[model samples]
Structure formats: structure tokens, C-alpha cells
Target: MKRMIFFSAVLGIGAVSACGGGGGSSAQPIAIDFAPLGIPNTDQEHVSYKVTDKLIVTYSDGSKKEFPLSYEVLLQSGDQMGSYKWGQLLDVNAQPMSNIAYTKGEISWNPDANSLIKTSDGKYFIITHFEEPPGMLYASELDPNTLKVKSITPIDFSSVGGTIINCAGSQTPWNTHLGGEEDYDLNSIYSVSAGGKNPAYVQCTKDSNGYFTGNDVNGKSNYFCGYVGGVQRYLKDLNIDPSNGYLGDKFNLYNYGYIVEVAYTNGKWDVAKHYITGKYTPEMAVVMPDRKTLYMSDDGDYKGLYKLVLNQPQNGFNKNWCGTLYAAKVKQLSDQNGGTFDVSWIELGKACDSEVKAIIDKKPLLTDIFDVEDPSACPTDQGFKLITEDRINECLRLKVGQYRSSKFASDDEVKKAAAFLETRKYAAYLGASIEFRKGEGLAYDPDNNVLYYAITEIGGSMADGKGDINLPNNMCGAVYRLVLDQNYNAYKMEGIVIGKPINRDPNDPDYQKYGQKWACHPDYVANPDNLKYIGYNTLLIGEDTSYHINNMVWAYNVKTGKLTRIAWVPTGAEVTGVFAHGLVGNNYTMTLNIQHPFVDTFRNADGNPVNSTYNDQNKDKRKGILGIIKGIPAGLLKLTH
Candidate 1:
């Protein structure tokens, strides 16, 4: 999470002396440590709050202050869905759709990201995204004092044709929420066929122009092949009927996979999809201080690391959707400790959002851009290049000359469309390294001119020792630190915090004593997902993994090279939406969400549910939580060493 640092006037560094018992002499910096959470007992299943229940602050004068450390639950998923303001699907006339299920059973309980927006009038609203097939976003008015929900208003995405799998997001520098759509449907866009899942949904066949010939594709009984099928499901969930004509005649795959900006204006929420930000399964897009440059993390196996630089820096990124897209091609420096790399950018293409959106509006098929053939049958003599993208080996050749569409005047125009529309495949064709596995979260440290990128796991093509990324399999994952240049472009990367893999056998000598049955070390972070930069030397990491019984949130001090566990979730839950909202009063607060608890599907060695004990202890198995950890002293956040 990227946030603007807030320094309290009352608790500034100058006030340290006043906090030191009003002494005339200056006080030394206070020493602070968050007591780490211990490993859960063998039979333990619920959340373990073994970490000290207090924030201990020791002054140079030997005086100590202990503030209670507790999590304040702001909203629960089940509770929100059961409320009146939970929101319902709207029709073409903007009226709530009737007979639609709005209960907890009908809606998803997975809360992924939270962006707290403070309006100019001192009003606070948190935009939360639910990770579901048909994703949902809601604006909850938060009480400034307690950071609790006062009212909930569902943000309508019907204007942008709705979104699917809304994942991790960041609060933009312009004070709006920038969300991502994790559209994995693109991976199978060329493979899945019409009526593959349900024959009753088959409507019409594609014409020679690649457009639907008959019936409304958004209709309940209408189904299209590839990416369109995914969009059909999303529309169906929204209760959109064929007769209503809600994107029923013209549905495009490119519209669904991009960065979405949501802003509260004049007491209403407005949304826009930024087509210029390329298309991929984006986990989060972190904007640099320049505001025009963005580093977006692609969340999938064999994906590319994307960067977008908006042309009009004076107007900032939100002004217009015109940018130059680039992907990283990394040369491995070493394979030790999750590997190090020398990173260089490969310019994909440049175009405005409207230009690409116009091409997308045509509803072109995958074959319209490139000729794709199986790797084994690739005709190298015919200029086909063998490339691995999305872990699929394919022979691809960009179309040219007479093969080009008349709508696009030049080959450059078609290339630009291909660059933004089929980003991953196009990057591979352009020779950009696309072997990253499970790229998760991104955080920029402007003070150090560094960017922190988290790779949730290391496997697949990344460890095959045949591609750009050749490393040992480390399912435990690692957080990489990228050194950026004056232009905010990452040039070098190395693993800063790497998880240690251990024996998983219960009979192992270390298993009984240290609870090392998990694949990764229990004391350290595994599958680091959401990251929040706190202070000058601390980075907060949240986990989303099955390596450990309980997902944890850890604080790693960059200066000290120490990793301390700050919090953990109930069994089978991910620690997500980790945001460090700077000083609130005299104390600092950080927001976190526990997603999908007590729903462990991963099994233990004995073939029993890994969180069976937890399920037995807890009654509700599908509720998620939005909470905050308060009582952190402002002084702690000012630590430079």
C-alpha cells in the first residue's frame, strides 16, 4: 500500500523532550519492539494472540509507556451483506433488479482490498473490494475517531460494464481508489469454447468479422466462447437481462482487465476503467511519486512485470489514459536466496486509452493480432517465434501487410492494440522476460529510491532452469527489493527477505519441538502478499499461503534485518488489505482484513482438514473481517534506524 506520511504537530520530533518528563535536556530516541507471536501449539486452531497485548515504549530516561494493543473490528462480511445498504444489482434503467439474491449465501465474503478516502470536507469513506467472480465494491462511511463503519453504499460499476475478481488495490496520489481486476479468463481466452460449461447458454456463432451474429450475448441463455464466456457469467450474476440491453449487443474482453479508478464526487461514486494501463492479472498498481509512472504487479505463473508511464506528466495519471507501456527483461545475477537480477525495460508500445478502446470495441479474436501455433508444430522458417507465456508454449507471429485489418491504417496501430490488449503474449513476442511466478504485492520506498515486490511462490517455469528465471523451487516465497534510478525505473533487484523451507515430516527431529511440519519456517513470513511501507525502516508484510496453518502479518525492520510477527489470522484465512494509515491523533494506526476464515480446504498429512480443529471451535466458517491495529506511538513511526 502506498500512502502519504502524516506527522502530527503535537507529537513531532520536537515534542520528544516534552514526552521525556518535561526535562530541560533533549531525550534520546525511544526503543520499541513488537513482541512476536509464538508458534501455535500442536492442537491450537484459533487465532493466537500470544504477542504482547501492549505496545511497550521505553524512553531514554528509563520511563516506559505501555499502550494496549488490540484489534478493533470495524465490519464483518456477513454483517455487511445482511444490511439494508449492502446494495443490489441495477438494471438498464438504474433501478435495483428484483428477485436477485442479496443474502450472505448469494454474495461473496472475501474482502481483498481497502482504500480509505478522506474527502475535502473532512468526511471519511473506505472503499472495499470483494474478490468474487462478479466482483463487488462498497463505500463505507467511517467514523473518523474510531474508524468504524457508519454507513455502507455499494459503488455501482454498471457504468464501466461491471468488474470481475477485484483484487489488491492502492489509494492513488490524487486521493482516489485505484483497483485491479484479476482476469484469469484471459489465460484461457483461446482455449475455452462456446457452450463448454452449459449447452443451454449457447446463443450464436461468431461471424467472419468476429462479432456475435444473433441474440444478446449478455442474455441468461446466451453464451460465447473464450473470454466472452467469462464476461457472460459476470453479467448473469448482475441480473442483466437480454431485453434490458446492458452491453447485450457489444461486449468486449478488453474492457474487463485494467486498472479501475473510483472517486467520490458530489455525494456519489464515479468509476472509470483506465485502458492505458495494459491488460493482465494485476495484483496491484503502485504509482511512483512522479504520479505519471506506475509499476503494476502481474499475479500469475510466467507473467510479465509491467510499467506504464503516462505522457502528460503535468496533468498526472488521472487526467488522461495515454501512456507508453514497458515490461522488464531480467538477467539473473545469482540463484542463491531466491535469486538476484539485473532488470531492464523493453518498450512494448505507446497509445492512448481511446485508441486501444476503439480497437477493443471491435471485439477482435486472438487470431486477429497474432498467428498462434503449438510449440512442437512451430514453422521457424515462416518467422514463428517459440515463446512461453502463461506457462503455455506457443509459436507466435504478428500479422502484417494484407493480413492487417482495414480499420487500423498502419502496422504500428495494430501493434499498439496488440501491446495493450494482449499484453502478456505481446511481451513474450517482444522478448520481455515473462517467467515471474505469482507476483503479488508492490510498495515503493521513495526515501531509499527502492521498490519492494513480493513473489508469493517460486515454482513453475521460474524454477524449470530453462527460461529467464532459473531458481530452486521455494514454495515459501520471497520479497524482492528493486533499486530504482532517477527516472523511477527499476534497474536492479535482489531478494531482501527470503523464506526458509523446512522438512514437513512430523517425525523430523525439529517438528515436535518447533512445529516445523509446515513447508516454510513457522517463525518467518511465507507467501508474502500485501505490503505496506511504514516509517523509514519498517515494511509490513501480510501472508496468503498454505505453508503455515495460520497466515501471519510481519514487520521487517530494514535497518536491523529483523523480522517480527505482529499479527496472525484464524486458520485458513489470508491476511489482506494491509494499509498503514499514518498518524491518527498521537498514535499510529494500520488497517488489516482477515479473509475467508475457517474454510481450510488444504489437508494435513493424516488426510484430515488442516483447520479441522479451528472449524470445530468456530461456528461461522465463511465470515471475513475488516479491522485495525491501534495504539502505535507516533514516535515509533519516526524511527530512522
Candidate 2:
């Protein structure tokens, strides 16, 4: 739900003109009020998208005011295994149980992921999303009876201050919460655009330690708008309008972009940062059966997969932080979308927070972490000290999965580079493959001993040049399955589900005529992301794409290889975070955040109109929607043309 979606991020600026017209914000003021469309009743509480939460707003006088704030729900859905679904909206109040709900009101926005935690002692849920963590592990307790928020209390991480840029996360097997800090600007030198989703997939005209000179189609440097970085307080360069109050967060910079572990046990909560996790633009982490070995996915294009191997496993992620972080080196046996590949892990570095902290305190320059140079390649008398911008940039050419093992002989140098400072670059130096694009969510099927990774897009110009998944004209998206063995080692990684793109030209009049068939919507799925394994080898994929009319959650029966549409959001909205959090018998509860639903007159992430609705165009502008669907009976969902 909390996607660092590279292209989506670029479009999030809403006002910018990019690959297409839709996605970003419009410059004009609000002129039209809207309502939920296609629903049977206007009296439905779920259809009203207003919020009453008081937000801390600041004025030019340096004074602050409490204003009623509303949010656009981007991703929503909680645990979906309970008898009756119970839903909660970030801004709106709605029941967790329901089949159909209209996202109305633009009051609340960007609610990320919801997880239903049901226990013999009690039933509860946890939610996470955008730049709003008031504490490291804080929670506003809801009444045990009324379920209304009563008061908030900090859980953990009070020492290092609370977390920032808390993006998407995954629930652990041990009843803990894992949220990754996915701030794209961490390195100063951004590989992505300012606030963009996955930089690897999007067409970035600029990347730098110097001035970005690339021009938009209009011949203007979008970099001037605080898009590129790699210098001191680089955000100052983006040229965001001060009056629009569009300046970036200084907290937006450092101490973010890590995997945060929150433990909820004994009616209490605790938090910690796994410094050894080896940071990148992280999406989510999936722990294996041993609990000591884990795999993590980064959100950007051309990014590599990572692993954490604890020296010893703790009951929970206690104060313990010592571990070894490894970057994956993939051996592609085939060039197909679901090709089988041999996998290897390269040891990056090992340490607790103190060791990492010391290096930061002494030599915190961006390149200082990997301060060692290959003396063999040295210029006679000089030894390698600090890497330069050009030097790191050269790493993009290394062979995938070849890290630290052979080509690079400096053990200590590999230690620092692969472990700290600049991780993604270091992995590239070791030759770890960075081919995955827009890697979003992680799901582990213990029953099947296989894991799922969603590559949101495979083709288009985004897949051009070297790293193309090249499925002919494939554009929608694809999901890869990593089948693990007895030791949780990935033995087979192949494409399991492929999204078929509607190949017809958009301008063609018959485009709408074929819209009713599965070929148009994808017989299996489209632009798949955020996979949740809901037992019985079934995977629930939460979707996002400007390519499709509406983003939906598709149920894929692994055993049967059947794809079914279970639920979808309003136009301009993405049905994300199909969480199986609350699981009890045939019924389940999933809290879903309906994000960025545009009004009939409004636009989407790509800056396109909600297209007047495939269901009905008379509807009003879509508001932030938070609702739950109960008894999502598995298999094919009946569709209408």
C-alpha cells in the first residue's frame, strides 16, 4: 500500500507533465464537488469520504493551526480470513464488514497497509502509511469495547527518535510488525526523481553528484524542481514553490531508509532498527522458517534482492541487532519472464548498531563507508580511500550475482561497501543482478514452501535497453515465484502469473467493445503487486496501474492456476494491501485503504480523467475510501461487460 512506486512518485507531484498527462496534481483550484457513483443507496456511510481529524497546519507567521484534514486512500484491505470482514478507514468511519463501498470525500489520503491481528485473548489490527509516524513504535489505543481511538502512546525507538518515511511493511510469523523506511533521497545522489516510486523503471532524465541538465519535452529541466540530488541540502534545487508550501522534509533526508521491526507482545509494543539489514529503497522483508534467514525486496528498477542471516535467532527482534546482511547474485539460466535461475548470496558485512554508528560519526561522507579500494588496481603508490561519483556509476556494468566472491578480491573493502554507506552500488560492484522492476510486496507460502515477488511492470520503454524482461510486447506486469526447499533455499524462481496487455491501440473505437472479455482485463492479472498468501496456495494480488481503467485485487489459485477478480476500487483508485491479517475460519477481516480515487472530472496518477467511469460517469469525484469486504469466496468472481 505504501509504495515507493518510482513513476507514481514522479506523477505524485500531480502538476508535473511527464510520460503522459495524468498522475500528478493539477494547478487549478477545486471547482466541482463530487459524490460516489454506481452504488444503490446514497445514505450509505461508506460512500461519504469526509474526515474530522484535526491536523497540525502551519501558517507563514510561524503560527500553527488545527485544521480539519482529509486524505486520499491509496491502498486498503486488512486480514481477510475472518467470518465477516470488518473495515476501518483512515479518515472516514466505516464498518469492517461489507461487499460494496464507494470511496467518497477527499478529506483523508494515503493510508498504506492494514493487518488484522486476532488472538484467543482479543482481536486487534495495525495500520501503516506515509510520512506520519509520530513515534518509533507509537500507537493510539482504540477502546477495547468501542474500537474508538482513545489515546496514543509511544512503543519503542524513543532513543533514536521516532521513524520517518514509514512506507509499506509485512506482518511477521511471530506477531511483529516490520516497516521499511523507503526514502529515495537518502544517498544525496538520487538514482530516482524527487519523491518518485521506483527509479529503475521510470525514465529519469537526470542522476547526479552534479547539476542535472536533462530537459523535459518542454525543454525545461525538471531537475530544477528538487527532483535530483547528490549534494548538500539538495532539495533546495527542486524549485518547489514556497507559497504552495511544497518544500521537502529535512527529516526526509537521513536516518530513514531502513527496515523497522516492531514487536507486539504481552500487551506491549517495542521497536528496533536492524542496522545490519543493509539498506536500499526497501519495500518489504519476508522471514524464512528458521527466522534467522530473511529476504528483502527494494522498490526501484534495476534493484537487487537482499538477505539477513542472524548469528542466532532471538524469541523476537529484542535489543539484539547483530547479524550478517547478504546481497543476492542471480544466475539467469534463461531469458524468459519466469526463467529459472541459480541463486547465490554474497556476504556484505556484519555488525550491531554501535559499529555502524561509529563509522557514521567519524567519516559520514556518502562514499566513506566503502573507503577501501582494490590495492591491486591502485595507481602505484596511492591506496584506495574514498569512491567518487564516476567510480560508483561504473558499477552498473558488473555481472549480476557476481559480488565479492571472485571479481572483487578486497575482503575488507567489500565488507564496507556491500554492508554500509552505499549498498545498492556496492552490490552492483559484486555483480548482483539488478533486473527486477518496481518490486513491491513479499509473500511466503509456508504450506507450499514458495515465495512470491511482484514485478509490477515488464515492458514498455521502461523495460528498454539492458534490463528488459522482454515478454515480446508484454506490458501489464508479471509475478515471479521462488520455490524454496527444506532449508528455505530458493531452488526455483520462475514466472507463475503473467499479465496480458490489451494490445489494441487506445484510440481505436473497439477498445471499449472488447472491454468485457478477460483478454482485455487480462485473463490472469494485470500489473500485479503486493502479494498476500492466503493459505491453500492462493495469492491475493493488490494492483496499481494507469494502464487499467481501475486498480483491483485479483485472487490467484496457485494449485489451480486460476485468476479471479474479487474486489476493485473506484476509478483513479488502487485496491491495495489485500491483507490476510485477521484470519479465522472461512471468514476474515481485511482493512483496505482506497487510495487517490478521482472524481469523474478528476484525474489519476497519470493525470488522466477518471474516464467518466466504466461503471457510470455521472458519479462525483472519488474521495478517500476505507472499507472491508467479508467472505471473499475464493475462485472466479463473476464479471460484467
Candidate 3:
């Protein structure tokens, strides 16, 4: 299972404190060898803890600190969850209670609506804690009143023969949990029924080997073929060799960069049809207000946005996920040519059908892909080569739905494509001294309808220890917000502030008005006049203080977009990103994993899959859940509330 924790990019170097004391008084820092923690030490893995019975910490220095179970903590958590709660820290038979697994994990709450669903079945809200993508998923089902796990059930995703990496707790139209994965190989979505089994739901695919197919006629990439380490190179290296190539024949991986659904009745998974075909990859599935349509992001080569429309109704409560795919294209005005370019909005209705096809074959132009001023441009230097709409319509008319071209195109085609791509525009240009890590742990605020993402500062060479207060090339991260215009027509970094400067181009009209230049290296967001910089990572905003734990991007709300750090975790407990589980009572959840330099995913212009490879791998760390059950005590916060 390829765990997709994006936080490893935030590698902060701090003093290694000791694991102080034991379960009674507040334990001081003490020593703890990570090797024994059983956590995956890769940049993609993490170690999570629930403040239960006691606060347990195995420090890097080989000592242990167990904070005694505190009733006060439990009470506090209860207040936050809307009631007082308690549970048995011990297992059903009265054991030490240690069956927690860690991988790419998330923390979620069961809202009133979801709680009603669970209560009808005799279960209450559970602040699920588990390792994402790698470890066995386990949730602490605690009572909102007592703040305890009424029961301890493993959030299992083993059916598809894979692990759960980074997952988004999708609030289904039917009001269930659609836990997704960062597993590019075995990408499956699981559902947690109201009153179901331990896992509650099963894989969405019918069989273990989930079904996926790209809708273009050029075929797919190696990412789809399920090549072990091939995804990393196929994406970053940018060019795919069609024949006699080392990575494989071509980039068939695109064929597999699709979504799947978990079935509860039968232990199986059913893959969904492709939403957006060329030059894009889908991550974080958020259903639009319309309920039937889903807004997805491009974790692929295109680095854009998209939406998934359910062409067919979800089979009632049966959990069916068959839908039509549509890529997002934003409509923006271009100052250079006095033209309006749509960035990430999909052309709707029949108007899109023909254009979509032609864009697939004729290949879209790459003039300005990421110019902040030109919302439609990313970079004119390198962009995708999409086929035109006419050709796409022709293929559709012929009932041709697959791309059969060689994995890698011919040399002549490559040369022509490369030249055209070189002139492509960029949505946000990083230049030689700048770079932007792909955003991760993305979530939308229903209340505000704003999109949040984290950008890791992992790659790019660092200078000597001059600027390094602790380690060289430290992962000084940034979090960014994609504020949807009132019309929700597009999202931009305009008027967004990060660090010192407001992310505005001086030449643009809004630049001087905002009085900011140079956006953060990774991501940023603007709320009114005050702009807040979110490190490239997952984020959680609380009432008072903000938290920047390791890879976790936890922050406190300053009413609007302003942000401040309240808590931070250094290494071992690296948080990749954060997600707000609306079903889980809107309680926030963050994912953690090991720290590494190269942890990422990429897709070809044709929507092929790719991954990042790291040289020095951490050995001990694994994946697990990190739950922040606000307003509760420690002891009562047990397996069974």
C-alpha cells in the first residue's frame, strides 16, 4: 500500500526532548526508540496517538512517558463534542487495549445526521483513529457525553488487498462514510454503514483487482499497469518511452487513475468510470451542493480541477457509484490577448462533449498555465497536449473509448508535443528559485465553501546551515486556501497573503491593492484583507491556538483567514495533511507519516500515474490515526464509552 501523506515535507528540526514521566502526573520528556513503535519509517508513514487512559509517548531517545488517564481531559472533550462521555480504556475482556494500526490516517466525527444513522443501528459517534494507507484502521467509538469508545472496531480496508493511505471521509448522498485511499495501485473507496461490521463496508470493486480505464484513445500509463516503483519516475521524469524503455512500454498508468466504491453487502469494490480523461488525475472527492455532482482535484500532470457527475442514481441505500466524468475549466480574461480562458471549469452539457473530444486529440495549447495574473495559465514552458474536440467526438461516435496508442508516443510526435508544451502557460510559476509541492489533505468548508490544501517544502536543494536553525533543507511548509468566488466559478491566489508578501503580481491590478508580492513557496489564501499562509500540508483550525504538528498542519482560527500556530510535532509523528470529517460531527482529523524528501504523485499529460522516490528511507515509523477529541478527559476516552 502506497501511503500518501504529504506532510513529510514539513521536517522541522527541534531539540529532542526526553519522554518525561508515566501515567499519573504530567509525564516529562523521556526516551523512546522509534524502531519498536512498529510504524512505517518512510516519508509516507506516521504514528498517531489518542489521549486515552493515559498519554503514551515513546520518545526518540529511548524513554517512555505515559500520562495518567485524566477525567478532566475527557470532560473537556465531551464539551467540545456536545456532551459528556466516557468509555472503558481496557478491551472487552479487560486487556491493555493495544490493537491500533497506523498508516495514512484521519480523524473524523459523526455529526447529528450521521449520528442519527448510527443511533438507529445502536452505534454512536466515533472519532476514528487509524494509520492511513499502510496500517490497520481502528476507530475509537466514544460517546459524545462520556468521551469513550463504546466499542473498538477496526476500520478495515484489507478486502482490496491494500492499505488505506490518505483518505477523505466523503459525506455520501445517502449519509455514510466513503473512506478513500492514497493507494495508486489498489485505489479503492470503502463505506462505513450505520450499523454494520467492523469495517462496516467493503471495497467498492467487485473483485480485488479493481477495474479502471482511461476514456481516451491513446491508451494509459504504467501507473494503471500497477508497476511497483515505476509511478514515481514515470511522473517526475515527465517523458515516457513507448518502446524498449526501462520503466515499461508506455504510460498506461493513466488507464488506472480512477475512483472506486466499497460495497457493504458483498465484500467487493466496483470502479467508477473515468471522469476527466486526459492530462489529469483525481484526488479528494467532494460532492457539490447539487449532491449528484462531485468536485475533484487534479493530483495529476495537469494540476487543475475537475468534477464527477453521477449519470445514474445511487442505487438507493445499496451504495452504487457509477458516474460520468467532467474536467474543471475556469473562465478567465486574458490581458495578453483580450480573451477569456476557463481555468478549471468543465464545459457543460453538449457544448462540452465535442470540445472535450477535440481537446483530447488536437491537444490544448500551453501558453500560460500558471500565471497568477492569468488565472487560466500554468506555465507556457511545459503543459499538456490534449486532442481536439472534433477528434474526441469522432472517437465517441465510433464507440472508441480507450486510448490505444503506444505507451510512449513516436519521436516525431514527442518532439512536436514537447515544443508545443514548452510554450504552455502556468497557473502559478515557481521560476528557477521557486517550486510548489502538490497540495494534499484537501477539504472544503461547507459553511464557507472554501477549498484548503497543503504544499510541502521538501524537495529543492537547500543552502548550508546558514538559514538552518536545526536541519538542512528543513521542511518549512505552507498551507494554502482556494477561496471560491461568490459565484463559485473559479479559485485563485489573488489577494492571498503568505508569510511577508501578499501573493499578488505587481503588474496585476490587485497586486498593489493587496500590497503583497511573492506568494509562499507552496500555498497561500486570502480572507478579506488579512491573508494567511498555510504551509503545504493538511490543516485544522480551532478556536484559540493553531497546531503545526510535524506533517500535520493544525492551526487556530483568527475569525477570518488569519492563522497562528498553537502546537507542533517535530519528527516521528509527522502529519501529512488534515481533513474535516463532516459526518464525524465536523470534528477535524489529520494524517501523519514518516519524514522523507521525495513523497508525491504525478500524472502524465494523458492522465498517467506517477510517484516520487526517496533515497534514504526511514525504517521504523508506520501509519496510524491521530484523533483530537476536543472537550474530554483521558481515562474515559477509552475503546468503549
Quantify all predictions' global Cα lDDT against the true fold: 0.66, 0.47, 0.28
Off by over 4 Å in 1: 1-32, 42-52, 56-65, 80-104, 191-230, 233-250, 314-319, 504-508, 514-517, 583-588, 603-609, 616-619, 634-641
Q: Rank the candidates by lDDT, best first.
A: 1, 2, 3
Q: Candidate 1: what lDDT?
A: 0.66
- The Cα RMSD of model 3 versus the native structure comes to 18.2
* Residues 563-587, model 2: lDDT tens digits: 6664545445565554434433322
Model 3 poorest 10 in a row by lDDT = 390-399
Q: Write the per-residue lDDT of candidate 3 for residues 522-619, one digit (tens) a residue.
A: 12221111011222221342110011112223342423443433222222233322222222222221222222212322221122332222212432
lDDT of 3 at 127: 26
Identify the runs in model 2 with alpha carbons over 4 angstroms from their true place: 1-108, 117-123, 131-158, 190-254, 265-268, 370-414, 460-473, 505-512, 515-522, 583-588, 599-623, 631-641
TM-score of 3: 0.42
Write the residue-wise lDDT of candidate 1 on 1-641 in tens digits.
11000000010111122244312244443555667776665555344322235655565777766556655556555454334334233333334433222113334556777776777676777677776545677777766565556887777787777776678888777778888887765442333232232122233334343433333345332322323433444454323222222234435556776888888777688888888788888887888878788988888788989999988652323525788999999999999988999999999999887888777777655556766665677798988788877666767678767777665678987898778888988998988999999898898876687899999988887898786889999878999999999989999989989886665567866555544336567877788998878654678898887777777888888768899887777676777776525433344445576676765543432334456666567645455655555555555554211
